[model samples]
Target: MGHPHRLGIVGLGNISAAYLDTLADSAQIRITAVADLDTARARTLADRLPHARALSVSELVASDEVDTVLNLTIPAAHAEIALAAIGHGKNVYGEKPLAARMADAREIVAAALAAGVGLGSAPDTVLGTGLQTARHAIDDGLIGRPLAASAVMVTAGHERWHPSPDFYYQSGGGPLLDMGPYYVAALVHLLGPVRSVTGAASRLRGTRTITQGPRAGAVIPVDVDTHITGVLEHDSGALSTITTSFDGAATDAAPLEVHGENGTLSVPDPNRFDGETRFFELGATQWRPLPTAAGYLDSARGIGLLDFIAAGPDRAARANGDIALHSLDVMTSLLQSAAEGRRLELTTTTERPLAVPLTAREVWSQRE
Candidate 1:
């Protein structure tokens, strides 16, 4: 509605730095205000931005100068912040794990729909050139008729680096809910919405030790699932084996691979913005990197927000919240399936319009 979108950021945590760095040079959105439960932290971030003021959550949400609220709060706060922004007639872009529960995520969506305002969520990794290129190749029939896929993500635990890692072991921050969105979102973009899901999860580590940082040598209890493996049945008749762990060692596990009738498309780590994706034909001995029409130039958050804003008010807006909710449903089914030892059926389907194309220059120019 204005010359440039006005952005009001609600949380000034470590992850918020990434968004600030990316927005620093953008002309599309200006940081008008910032807020955090810790007023000092909010002030710190605001001090670094031009014409940005630190304020309370209520003030930020109620500010008429702010057109969009970037909900960077913790997982438990996502639904509340977004709902408040929507209630105030402001567009909202929330961080991942949209909400702690499926019902809450649905409520946020419903509120946005009722308010007729824009709603988006993050872990926008799917928009990266790596995944987008893979999507394009699959759609172009380079990997005719997807048959199956797999994704594996592992970390010793976040206590090593995160100043406050206690939440990661809580309900909203386990391996399934924490890292599952990135992989699941990519799968949805490539394969389609899941038809069913079954999973087996366990607290593989009784306690986790911080390997580095000031917290080194500190041990923390692992209350949630530290290891989870699941089977996803997609509407396209493709099966995806997904797994995540906070208790495992490192390996050169490919992030994702789609087996198709003609060949296999191996996608680089979906969590990143740029990488070479390879396609191996049935008869070929080697995997060849597919030529990208354009380079991915946006930061983790920039691409999704830019696209949503670029689509303008008339077009159907795409955001991470939709994918986050679907991912939550899949994870919920996985937990249920694991308990019952049977596949859980999913009623929703994943479908999107054809992807916008990018020129090679556009794709390559964005690389750091």
Candidate 2:
């Protein structure tokens, strides 16, 4: 485990480039193989990475050179790829929401446990400086006994710029499921596990047209809710109101915030690795920036995967299946509650994953 965690990437889409940029300099992982349903795409990516070979999806998942599967596939295919990798006795670290369905995601967790391999998933943005600073503030009582939080994400839609936008409108690709993971994960980090939720949603448009890329002006039908608003009741007695949408133009809401008996904190966007965390105490007249006291420095997407593997054999990965599954359960229940017109109690709950103290890559990926 002292050496790099050889990675077999299963998707080579737009987002894969961002990951490649991070992996280029990582100390804990390196891409050894690349795969996609589009063989040409896989080959093209492999050609660029040093020593990375192109493989079929099945081949990549089972390759002897690969230790973990990096799943960058679409939301619908996440579970399928993960199960394949886990079945081959490889660890898997994937993009957010874990999987599209609760049952499917649960299967990945169960299989990983059965195989004795670790499980992990993203928005490891929680392991970054901005949120970690806020968490430190909470732990230090800068925010006295966290009382509540609110998370908001709003955009007209992704069709304005994305080339192939069909998946954003499909069964697993609504604003809540697609984008809610970041907000929900951050909320859990800030406020702890959610116990129940009551949600209401709206879909103001039936179809959307792509305004950018090769498929410009191509219309896509919308099947899932485009605007979702809900409240999560955390097990710690903290409450959070969340609103995620692809229907609105914009809003002035902070991406995230936490309030407590002593102060309030304005958190940076959870989708990013770093930003300023602002705080305003009860007696203060102005919001001041908190010094970055924790988390990875200048971290990037793949760093979370490094952190996951660096957790050693005994400690759970900082971005783990239980937390991801809990996040998914909260989101799915919110949408279900909206559909059923009732508050739904969650069956899943996760302990807050251990917080990351400020550390460099070398120090974190080491054995004393």
For TM-score, the strongest prediction is 2
Candidate 1 per-residue lDDT, tens place, 192-290, comes to: 888888899888767777666777788887777788899998887899999998878775788899999999988979788778889999999998899
TM-scores for candidates 1 onward, in order: 0.93, 0.97
Clashing pairs in 1: 121-321, 193-350, 293-359, 293-360, 294-359, 294-363, 295-362, 295-363, 295-364
Worst 10 residues of 2 by lDDT: 359-368
| Model number with the top lDDT | 2
Compared with the true structure, what per-residue lDDT tens digits does model 2 show for residues 100-201? 999999999999999988789988888889888889899888888999999999999999878998998998889999999999999998889999999999
Q: Cα lDDT for residue 236, model 1?
A: 75
Ten-residue region with minimum lDDT total, candidate 1: 359-368
